[model samples]
Structure formats: structure tokens, C-alpha cells
Target chain A: MKTLRLLYMAEVKLSVREMSSVIFGILLPVGLMGLMGMFADTQLELIRAFAAIATIGLVSTGIMSLPLSLSSYREKKVLKRYKVTPISPTHLLAAHVLHCFSLSTLSMVLVFLVAWLGFGLEIVGSLWLFLGGYVFVMIAIHSIGMLVASVSPREKTTGAISSALFFPMFLLSGATIPLTILPEFMQTLAQIFPLTHGITILTDIATINEFNTVSFLILFVLTGICLMISVKTFKWE
Target chain B: MGEVIRVSGLTKRFGQKIAVQDLHLSVRAGSIFGLLGSNGAGKSTTIDCMLGTERADAGEIRILGTDPRANRRSLFQHVGVQFQESAFQSGLKVREICEITHSLYENPIDWQKTVAEFELSDKLKTTISDLSGGERQKLCILLAMMGRPKVIFLDELTTGLDPVARRDIWQTLLRLKQTGVTLFLTSHYMDEVEKLCDEILVIKGGKELIRGTAADVVHRTDSENMDEAFVKLVEEGIR
Candidate 1:
């Protein structure tokens, strides 16, 4: 327990030192929501924009920062160094997960606060459901990032692969453009992305006071599958 | 003194290439044991297998009378390893690295003493990326010794250091030896081996070519020094 706490503290320090992750994972989402407040004339539009910004924060950390950090650790032989110590690889990985989760929570809080103050956006649905959906979305996206990190053979390739998946998801998964604005074929294709379901559930609960059981189940199943694959395929070096 | 490390018939292969084959070794407590090999001679593979980082194809390894594979946690608690390619995160400060490593052991050495001995007291707040190659090597050595392990593995311990820094490390190592810590060292510097090792094993193509005290091997090969003896042993084959 003491070792885990020390590892966690180290991980948190490292995460804060990574300026790029801080900018993309926290600042950008809050800034985007603040900008959206100017153009959003209705409560529905304001809620959708805030939800999309939250999704952006999740993706930035989950799909971009998490995999990049894990792969870089492997490339640098940090994991290899830990293998010789009393601390197991599982402990190191757990520290990383806890660090990323904390970052996600901070990002979420910042985005929510900015949206509330700047645009007067309020959650009309059950707060418990909204919070539950947010947690599930974060886990599902981070699990996918873990899967990518585990399968990538090199740090350089991990970046290329993560960006390849991230850019498309960012552009089409209702985070940047609403599903109504996308072409019918694109909207249908977006359904395959976990982020699409995440944004849908979030916006539904926040704006319309509706809960979509199907989307929630889809997010849960995706999280489970990705988590299993990542654990089974993880490589220390 | 009891044997701190014992290996027998250790074999490891990477696909079609056999890295180490039918290897056997033993290191008595409180001794500096040197392992010499050409590039790709399986020195690293053997160390990796003994450290439980790699599984051997066939062999038995006992470190302090414990199987490294079956009792890895307990084995690691008493063993420190410095790898040739090991690295810390660039963003971490030297002090932060020391503190984190200090927390991993049951009874760690004083971090301040380690820093002063390694000459890293001035660089405590410096990030890893800002440290020189010699400083990084020193930091690695310091971290390995922080646990105060009974047996320590040093791979290429002085690869990128100046003569003065190398001498300092050698002095520190000798001090550790005086404290009854067993040293398992691998180095390309023949002079370093000749000066410090009580027993030396020279290997080629994953097999032992010769093993003895440094002076004994030199006399047996009819050479004046370790470099000459090593070349002759490799060229003329071990007699």
C-alpha cells in the first residue's frame, strides 16, 4: 500500500509535468465550452455544446494522452526497470490508471464549471444518471486507449496509430459536429464509435431528461471488451 | 562463505538462435564476480534469466537459496539489478526518483547518504533529461544500492564514464564488497575486471571459454595481461 501510494504520487507529478496533456485534456475543453456560449442562443444548443466539450476532454486524455504515455514508458525501459524491483507491473499500470482517472475528473469539473457560469447550462435530468454515464464513458474510452497501448510495438507507431483513430473520432463522433448536421451515411457509421454513444447518452440526460438504456449497455460492453483485451495483451517492454 | 548465487545447465534461445547454452556459475558471498563475453555472447540473457525477467529454456537458478521464478517478490527484495538500457522518466527529478525507489524496499538505505556517495547531492532537483551520461550511470548505481541488497547485478557499469568517475565508482563498489555484499558484474573494460574481480568467467558463443581468478587466467593463457589473455583465449581456444 505504501509503494502504491508512492507510485501514485510519482505518476501524478509526471502527469502534471506533461504540459501538452494538460492543455489538450483540460484547457481545450473548458475553452471550447466558453466559446460555445457565445453562439448558443437556446438552452438545448447550450447543453449539447457543453456535452460535446466534455466528450472532447475525455477523448483527449483517453485516446491521445494515455496511450502515448504508456508506450513511451515502455520505450524508455521504465517498465523494464520496475520488473526487477519488488513492485509488479500490475502496480505500475494501476498507478497510471488512477492518475489518468484523476485527470479526467479534473477536466470534467473544469468543463462543467465553465459551462455553468458562462452559458447557464444546467442538467435537467437525474444528476445520478448523468454522473454514472460520465464515469462509464471515461472508462470505456480509457480502456480502448489501453488496448491500443498494449498492442503497439513501439512508441513512435503508437502515436501514429492513436492519431489515426483519434482524428476521425474527433471529427465525426458528434463531438465536433452534431449528428443531425452529418450526412445520413456518416451518422450511421458514427454509431460504431463508442464516443458517439457516449455523447448521445450525455446530451440526452443533460438536455432532454431522458435515459437511453441501449447506449448505456453499449458503453458498458465496450468497456468490458477493451479492458479484457488490454489486460491479456499488455507487454511490459 | 556460502554461495549467494548458483546456476546450472542454464539454456536460453531466441527463435533459431541459441543465446546461452549449458551454462553453470556460482558466486560466493562477499566477492566481486566478473562476467566477460563478446557482443551477443548471451551475458545479458543469462542475467535476465537469473533476475526472473526472462524464463530459461532449461536450467535451475537459486539466488540466496530461493528460486527466482517461484519467489520473485522475495528474491527481488534482496537483489538489486542495474540494466544496460534501464531509464527513468525524463520529467522526474533525481530526488523524486530516489524517494520513490526508497519506498519499494522493506529496509532501504538512507537516501541522503546514497546521494552524497553518488555525488548527486548537487543535482537533486535536476530532471533526468538534464543529467549527463555519467550522472545517469551514477544514479542507476545509486538506485540499485538503495535497497542494500545482498547480491547486486551491474551490467556495463562504467560504459560511459570518465576515468576519474570510473575510479570513484570502483572505490564505492569496493566499499560495498567490504560490507559483505556480493557483486555480479559484467563489463567490457578488462582492466576494471582485473582490478576488482576475485573470479572471472569469459564466455563466447553462449559457452564458457575459461573461468578462474584474473591472474590465474592470465598465467594459464601465457599472457601478460587480461586483454592479451582474453584475445589469446578467444583466438587459440581455451586449453
Candidate 2:
């Protein structure tokens, strides 16, 4: 427990010093939420916008910041340094995950406050179920990020792959532009992405007071596959 | 002195390539042991296998009397390793790097004092990626020493060091040995092995070519010097 705490403190320091997670993961989503609040019409529209924009934090931190850090560690041989230490490298990995998770949670809280205060959003739902779904969706998205980091052989490749995944997911997965704005074919194409299902479930649960089982099943299976492949192929050095 | 590290019949293969094969060695307490081999001669591989960086397909390795692979985390508390091509996260400052390493061990040396002793006080605030090669090497050495370990493994201990820095490190290593710390090192410099190592093992193609004192190896190879003996043995696996 002490080692884990030390690792977490070190991770927070190093991560904050870099500021990528803060800027992209936390601040970016908050900024985007403010922009979306300017156009929010009815209470339900404002409430649904919160669901879509909240997942931006997940994509930025999990898919972008998380893998980028791990890949850089591999690229710079930092992971090799941790491998020889008395603490298992997995402990360090947990620290990274925890750091990103905290940032994502913070982003969500800030976004909720902004939507409620700035836009007079009315969220009619089981808050507990919404919280549970939000946590699960965060885990699912992070697993995909871990998968990207695991499979990419180089830091450069990880960046390219992560960016390739990031822009489309952020744009089409309802994190930025609403999926309702897209044409029918584009929405169907967006449905192929795991993150799209995550955002859809969060939106449905928050605004309509219900879960989307099909989207839930899609994210669950995708999360399982991602976690399995990530575990099997993850490289330390 | 007791044997501090023991490797017997150790073999490791990466796909079809035999990286290390049936290699065996032992290092005594309070002594420096060197593993010498040409590039791709499996010297690093042997060190990696022993340090639990890579697992062996066959045989046994006991560092401080426990198998490294099965008990890496616990063993690492009593052991320190300096790799030839590894470094800390580039964004981390030297002081932060030291703190993280210091926190990993059950008991660590006073890293601040050691950093000052190693002439790294000025570099503490510098990000690791900005450090010069020699400075980075010193920081690595400082980190390895943080555990106050019983056995320290150094892979290519003086590869990039200048002549004066190399000699200074050799002296520091000798000083560490005097404190009853066992040293297991790998190097290509014959003079370094001759000067510092009590026992030297030379390997090629993942197999042991020779193991003895520098003079003994020269005598066995019918050569005038350790350098010549190394060349001859590489041409012929053993005398």
C-alpha cells in the first residue's frame, strides 16, 4: 500500500509536469462543454449534451494520454528501468491508470457543474445507475487505450494509431458534434466504434432514465476482447 | 567468501536463435566478476537471464540463494542492476527519479548524499532527457546504489565513459567491493577486466569460451596478454 501510494504520488508529479493529461483530458472537455452550453436549447438537450461531452475526457486520457505515456516509456526505456525495481511494473501501470481515472472523474464533475449551472440542465435519471454506467464506460474506453498501447510496437506508431482512433471517435462518437446531426450512413458508420456505444449508453441513461442493452452488450464484449488482447500482448520493454 | 550468484546449465532461445546456451558461472562475495564477449556474444543475454529480465529455457540461477524469476521483486530489494541501454522517464528530474527509486526499496541509502558524492547535486533539477551521457550514466549508477544492495549487476559498466571517468568509476566500484558488496559486471575492455575483476568469464555465441583469472586465461591460450587471449579464444571457442 505504501509503495502504491508512493508510485501514485510520483505519477501525479510526473504527469502534471507534462500537463498533457491536464490540458487534453481535463481542460479540453471542460472548454468544449462551455462551448456546447452556448447552444443548449431545452433541458433535455442540455442534459444529453453533458452525456456526450463527458466521454471526451475518457478518450483524451485513456486513448491519448495513457498510451502515449506508456509508449514513451517503452521508447525511452523507462519501462525497462521499472522492470528491475523491487516493485512490479504492474504497480507502476496501476498508478498510471489511477492517475488517468482520477482526471477523468474530475473532468466529469466539472462538466456536470458547468452544464447544471451554465445551461440550467435537467437530468432526469437514476443518479446511482448513471454513476455506475459512467464508471463502466470509463473502464471500457481505457481498456481500448491499453489495447492500443500494447499492440503498437513503437511510440511513433502508437501516436499515429492513437490519433487515428482519437479524431474520429471524438468527432463521430458524440463527444463533440452530436450524432443526430450526422446523416444516416455516417451514424451507422459511427456505430462500428466501441466509444460510440459507450456515449450512447451514457446519453440514454442520463436523459431518458434507461439503459440501452444493445449498446451495453456491445461495450461489454468490446471491453472483454480489449482487456484479453492487452494482457496477452503487452510488452514491458 | 560465499558464492553470491550462481548460474548453472542456463539456456535461453529467442525463436530459432540461441541467445545463451548451457552457460554457467559463479561470483564470490566482496569481489568483482566480469563477463566478456564480442558483440552479440550473449554477454548481455546472460546478464539479462540472471537478473530475471529474460527467463532461461533450462538450468538454474540463484542470486543470493533464490531463483530470480520466481522471486524478482523480493530479490531486487537486496540486489541492484544497471543496464547498458535503459533510463528513467525522460520528463522526470534527477531528484524525482531518485525519490521514486528510493521509495521502491525496503531500505535505501541517503540518495542526496550519494548524489553530492557523485557530483550530481547540480543535475538534480535537470530533466533526465537533457542530461549528458556521462551524467545520465552517473545517475543510473546512483539509482542502482540506492538499495545499498548486497549484489549489483552492471551491464557494460564503462561503455560510454571517458578514460578519466572510467577510471574513477573503477575506483568507486573497488571501494564498494571493500564494503562486502559483490559485483557482477560485463565489459569488452580487457584492461578493465584485468585490473578490476577477480574472476573473468568470456563467452561467444551464447556458449562459454573461457572462465578464469586474466593471467590464467592468457596462460591457457598461450598468449602474451589478456586482450590477445580473448581474440584467440573467440576464434577457437576454448583453448
Query: Highest DockQ among the candidates is held by which one?
Result: 1
- Candidate 1 per-residue lDDT over residues A34-132, each given as its tens digit: 887788888888888877778787788889888988899888888888888888867777888888888888888888898888778877887788878
Candidate with top TM-score is 1
Q: In model 1, state the lDDT of residue B182.
A: 97
* C-alpha positional error of residue B213 in candidate 1 after TM-score superposition, expressed in Å: 1.0
Evaluate model 1: give its TM-score: 0.97
Model 1 chain B poorest 10 in a row by lDDT:
B230-239
Taking chain B only, the TM-score of every model is: 0.97, 0.95
lDDT of each prediction vs. the true structure? 0.87, 0.87
Shift in Å, residue B16, candidate 2:
2.3
Worst 10 residues of 2 chain A by lDDT: A74-83
Residue A33 miss distance in model 2 (angstroms): 1.5
Q: Candidate 1's error at A232, in angstroms?
A: 2.0
Per-residue lDDT of model 1, residues B112-134, tens digit only: 98798778899999998888878
Q: What docking grade applies to model 1?
A: medium
